[model samples]
Target: MSEKYATIYKTIGQNIRRYRKEKGFTQETLAEKASISMSYLTKIEAPNCDKSFSLEVLLDISSALDIDVRNLLENIYSQPTI
Candidate 1:
C-alpha cells in the first residue's frame, strides 16, 4: 500500500484504540459490539499491520463506540508518520 493510505489506516486504528480505551472497553467487548471478530479488531489496531476494512465496518465501529465516523478519520495527515 501507498504511504498515504498506510498513514490513514494507522491513524484510524489509533483513533479506534484511543476511543475504545476511553470507553473502558476491551478488544473483545468492542469487537463483539461492532459485530466483528476480536482477531480482526486486533489486526486493525495493530500499528505494525496494514489492514483494510470496509466503510460498513467503520460505520459499525463508530456506532458501537458512540462516536462519529469523522472521529476515526480525523487527523489522518497531521499525525506523525508511523
Candidate 2:
C-alpha cells in the first residue's frame, strides 16, 4: 500500500484503541460487540499491519462503541506524518 494510506490506517487504529480504552472495553469485548473476530480486531489495531477494514466494519465498530464513525476518524486528515 501507499505510504499515505498506511498512515491513515495507523491513525484510525490509534483512534480505535484510544476510544476503546476510554469506553472501558477490552479488545475481546469490542470485537464481540462488533460481531467481528478478535483476530481481525487485533489486525486492525496493529499499527504496522497492512490490513484495512471495510466501511461495514467501521460502522459496526462505531455502533459498538456508541460513538459516531467520525470519532473513529478524528484527526486522521489533519495529523502530520510521523
Candidate 3:
C-alpha cells in the first residue's frame, strides 16, 4: 500500500482501539461481537501494523461497536504523509 493508505489504516486502527476502550470492550470481546477472530482484531489494532481488511469486516465492526463506519475512518485523509 502507499503511505497514504498506510496512514489511513493506522488511523482506523487507532480509532477502533479508542472506541473499543470507550465502550469498555476487550479486544476479544469486540472480536466476538464483530464475529471476527481475536487475532485479526489484534492485527487491526496493533500500532504500526497496516493490516488491510475488507469493508464487510469494517461494517461488522461498526455494527458491533454500535457506531458509524465513518467514525472508524475519521481523519484518515488528514494524516500527514511522510
Candidate 4:
C-alpha cells in the first residue's frame, strides 16, 4: 500500500464508522466480529491515515459488514464526476 492509498482507506474508515454505528455495533464488538484486535481497529479508524493494512483484515470487516469487498473499495476510492 502506498501513501496515495492511505487517503482512500481513510475515507473508507469514515464510511465504516458511519455504517457500523448505524448498524449498532460497538468498535469492540465489531473488532471481535472481524477477528481483529480492538487496538488494530482503533488504528484503522484513527484520523491519521495509513495505507498499510492486511487484506485478510479487510475481508473480515467486509464479511462482518455484509458488504461486498469490491463495493466497499469502490465506495472508498470513488470520486464524484463533474
Using lDDT, give the best candidate's number: 3
Give the top-scoring candidate (TM-score). Answer: 3
lDDT of 4 by residue, 25-78 (tens): 999988999998888788787777464677788889888988776645656637
RMSD of each: 2.0, 1.8, 1.3, 3.3
How do the residues 1-82 of candidate 2 rate in per-residue lDDT, one tens digit apiece? 5565787888898899899999999999999999999999998898785778888999999999999999999988786654
The order by descending lDDT is 3, 1, 2, 4
Q: Write the per-residue lDDT of candidate 1 for residues 1-82, one digit (tens) a residue.
A: 5665787888889899999999999999999999999999999999865788889999999999999999999898786664
Evaluated at residue 56, the lDDT of candidate 4 is 86
Question: What are the clashing pairs of model 4?
Answer: none
| Count of clashing residue pairs in every prediction | 0, 0, 0, 0
- Candidate 4 lowest-lDDT run of ten: 73-82
lDDT of each: 0.90, 0.89, 0.91, 0.75
Worst 10 residues of 3 by lDDT: 1-10
